[model samples]
Target: MFRIETHAISLVRRGLMAALIVAASVLIGATVALAESHGFAGLEGGTFAMGSGKHYREEAPVRQVTLQPFSIQKTEVTNAEFAAFVEDTGYVTTAEKDLDQSDYPGLPPDLLKAGSMVFAQPKDPVALNDINLWWRYVPGAQWRHPRGPESSIEGLEDHPVVQVSIEDAKAYAAWAGGRLPTEAEWEYAARGGLDGAQFSWGEDYDPSEGWKANTWQGVFPSIDTAEDGHHGSAPVGSYASNGYGLYDMAGNVWEYVSDWWIPGHPTKDQTNPGGPSKTLAEQFANSAVGARHVVKGGSWLCAPSYCFRYRPSARQPAERSLGSNHIGFRIVRDGVN
Candidate 1:
């Protein structure tokens, strides 16, 4: 009789454990739903003229690209939204984790500590040719502590979270029941229904038309006059939304997209181009040491005289593992919901 009672208790224990797991899953789903409700602008996708022939060579060979309908976040994900995700999953960001020795083959042990690249504004004018003058690999720089160990996101809850690597962004998207938008989708949405337009808002960068986006008003790296009422990242949706009702698609931060970087776009028309499918070595000169992924949308660091990439067609390659102060991301769903 005692043995029989013990077996019944064991069965009860297993049942209770299963019940707890189901409850946890329900809570997670609810959290993600709340996160998604913040506003996901839908696009009934069609063929748009992608890339630019007038600007950077990387955005050259403009192609007629087609896409399926999709829904994307109206604004970049904020610190509060990311905080909820971290609280739910205890997720650790890439910059917070110790560097793997294998990734940095020749690096010294002392340099393999947790860190990320951060943009430090120079007090005086610096050389524009080399980026090393303004950008630094700061130890303990992560999304929560955006600047360094001394900084925190205490009051800037609404600001878009930065210093998140592509891997980190992907993890957050998965948790939120979405995925990173492809470069094609990002540009399409950024264009805001204005095909072949130079800027997301229109053809000109006229502040007289109204401060459409948060970008550098003065010289980059050395000085920011803040004519748009922002020296750095402003709260998400601080400015006017585009035609599709998407905010901050042109500036404020450079967003990560799910595309490996190549020098130029394809010469022919295509449907749902997922970037090149060639091996990493073939695409990046057969060298795997510094593989790069496409980062779209220029940041506050962009200036007309230096980096005029605050347009829909501009693109740049960033190291896959590295995160920076000026880089953040938004998410997209497969279809409009």
Candidate 2:
């Protein structure tokens, strides 16, 4: 009788263990789904005017682009969300990894440390043509240590996580069961149903309307009036949402898009045109210093006199391997369950 009872108990324990495993799996699946869908705005995509002919040469030759339906996060990924991903996966970002010596032959040892480019505002107005006057490569500057090794994201949890490279953004998106949006998708969503507006909000851009987006309010790379109450990166959703209820689509940090960078858009209409697939070397005819991907929505460093690219049609090329303090990303989901 004792042996029989012991066997029964053992069987019961096995069954409980199996049941717990099943329950844990279900909970995990649910959690992943929640993470993917949370704070996402579904966009019913259609053909919209892409690029601007009036602004910079890169944005010239406006054309129509049709995109399939997709869902995008309401705001750029926040530091808290990225922190959770890092905590769960123990992932290390590109900026945190040591540089390959071979890539920087003969470079100074100190300059080869793990770090990222940060916007160091000059004390006095400097030449905007030379971005080097403001952008500095600081050692130990990663996403968590945004400003530098000494600076932390202590009070900036809600702010968009910066100093993340395209690869880093893709890893976080994969962990969350999503992917980076294409250039076409990002521009369409940034438009927020208003097809050809100058800014994300509308044609007229008057700060007296209470700063529609977080952009440089004073001299570029020098004096920031902080008229919008943000010296650098502002917390996500600090301003009003667009027509589709998406916030910070105009300014905050430049967002990464999947399409490779080309100088300008094709004039011909396109249906979800992902940029040219030729290798960066081939695309640039061997003139490019490095491979670059398109980053949209501009950043807080954008100013009227210097970088006035905080518009739906504005776009910029960022090196695929580099991460700057003014750059971050949002993710997108597609297809029905």
Candidate 3:
């Protein structure tokens, strides 16, 4: 009887262990799901005008595009969020890696340090024509140290994680079980239920009523009146959210899209138009042989006098291997389960 009782107690203990393991797994799964869905805003995507006739040539000849239901992050990926990914994955960003001298044939060996391009405001007024005047390639500048090696993200955890390359963005998206939004999807989301509006908020760029976004106020390259209350990149969701309840779609930082850089509009009305399947090098024979992705919206450097690309129509090419202080990204989830 004693032996039989002992066996029964051992079986009960084993059963309890199994139940505990299952419970722990369920809790972990719930935690991960919560983390992934934290900032995502669902959108019942539909057709919308993709580009603008009033913007740059690349944005001209606006075409209609239709998209399926999807979910996108309400705000750009924050530094604290990115830190969690890095801690979980132990991933190193491109800005943390040494520059490949082969890719830059004429660059000096000493100058090929691991860093990123940082936007340093000029002490005096400088020419808006040349962006090089204010933009500096600071060594040891990465997402952790946004300005340079000396800078730290201690107090800026809530701010968008800048200095992350397109590849890094993709990696983060993949880890989070999502992907970067296509150019069309990005524009559509940026529009925020408004069609062909000049700005994400509306047709007007007014800070007097209160800043709608984190864009340069006073002048380009030099004078920043801080009329919007922020001299540099503000924390994500600093301004009012758009119609779709999405924040920072206009400025704060340029966001990477999944599509490659194309100069012209779509050929026809496309349903869920993903940019050219071919890489930029393949699509444009004369273009540099590298991954050139489309970066949408604009950064804090964008001003009325200079680059007024803070609108939904504005688009720019960003090299995949490089990251900048003004560049970051948001993720999108296709189809709702």
Candidate 4:
């Protein structure tokens, strides 16, 4: 009968779809295995793999990939390194760029000066819903004065520099004879030999009773537990290294990457994808706002209670010109052959 024939066709379609799913899964597993063959940090302050079957990041998978290799700085760009870049290139960062009424919409007349967001005093607590409570509009909150005018990196030149914008990050990379890593490269490196990992270290948020990366230990905004031995950003290399000897690839500061987030990688076997040149705003008429750049390696402000983004593959984006105490960058240069 005609009805019987239609049922048969539907059954065939379902089987075919199932077959495709299996094939895709197999391909992804094989690709991940290849990466594993190269190296895995294993368990320590070292490896950060999440294991198979478990998803590390939501859309960003650790499955298969054939990518050209590159080197990343083991630690973030230290104040020492950034200071040198400034000396060599005399580059002015976005924080240094002047802003007017245009940059800050619906602002009061007194608040029109060019400034950047610097973390307010935790000693001074305020409501989470209130934006003005936690962030200070600092006149000099650039890579140099991090916490603003009263703050200085004088003795902490070894500390990873914060408040550097995407433009500033690019400038440093150019001067230092390197370039920024793409989102894939940044996450790959952040994993530090650990692939398909939920957190940079492993599946568990804490392990070995050993210290993890620098992050908010106690209540955010107020009362930091300081279990990681310091509050706010620590000196670079303060913690143990991952497989490739990278430090603070997790909580400390978010590093900027070369790629813009493209809803998701559209094809399999994508080689060194740099993300969509067009952004979410361009595609959607209602979305007047869009931040394309991918920020990896989550910052020290991350917490399990609020943001568990210390995981390597974690990402988000803000305007390139945006500055915050929790945002900073690392650099990548041509890797050694």
RMSD of each: 12.5, 14.4, 15.1, 16.7
Stretches off by above 4 angstroms in model 1 are 1-37, 100-105, 278-282, 285-288
Number of clashing residue pairs, candidate 2: 0
Question: For candidate 1, what is the lDDT?
Answer: 0.78
Top lDDT: which candidate number?
A: 1
Residue-level lDDT of model 2, residues 244-289, one tens digit each, is: 8889998889999998877788879999787877474246522323
TM-score for candidate 2, please give it.
0.86
TM for every model, in the order presented, reads: 0.87, 0.86, 0.86, 0.75
**Higher lDDT: candidate 3 or 4?**
3
Q: lDDT values of the candidates?
A: 0.78, 0.77, 0.76, 0.60
Kindly give the stretch of ten consecutive residues in candidate 2 with the minimal lDDT sum: 1-10
| Error of model 2, residue 97, in angstroms | 1.1
* 64-101: candidate 4 lDDT, tens digit per residue: 54345566666777666666555545556666555454
RMSD, candidate 2, Å: 14.4
Off-target runs (Cα >4 Å) in candidate 4 are 1-63, 100-111, 121-132, 262-269, 280-290, 335-337
Clashes of each: 1, 0, 0, 3
Residues forming the 10-long window of minimal summed lDDT in candidate 3 = 1-10
**Model 2 alpha-carbon drift over 4 Å, by segment:** 1-38, 278-282, 285-288
Q: What ranking emerges by TM-score with the best candidate at the front? A: 1, 2, 3, 4
Candidate 2, pairs of clashing residues: none
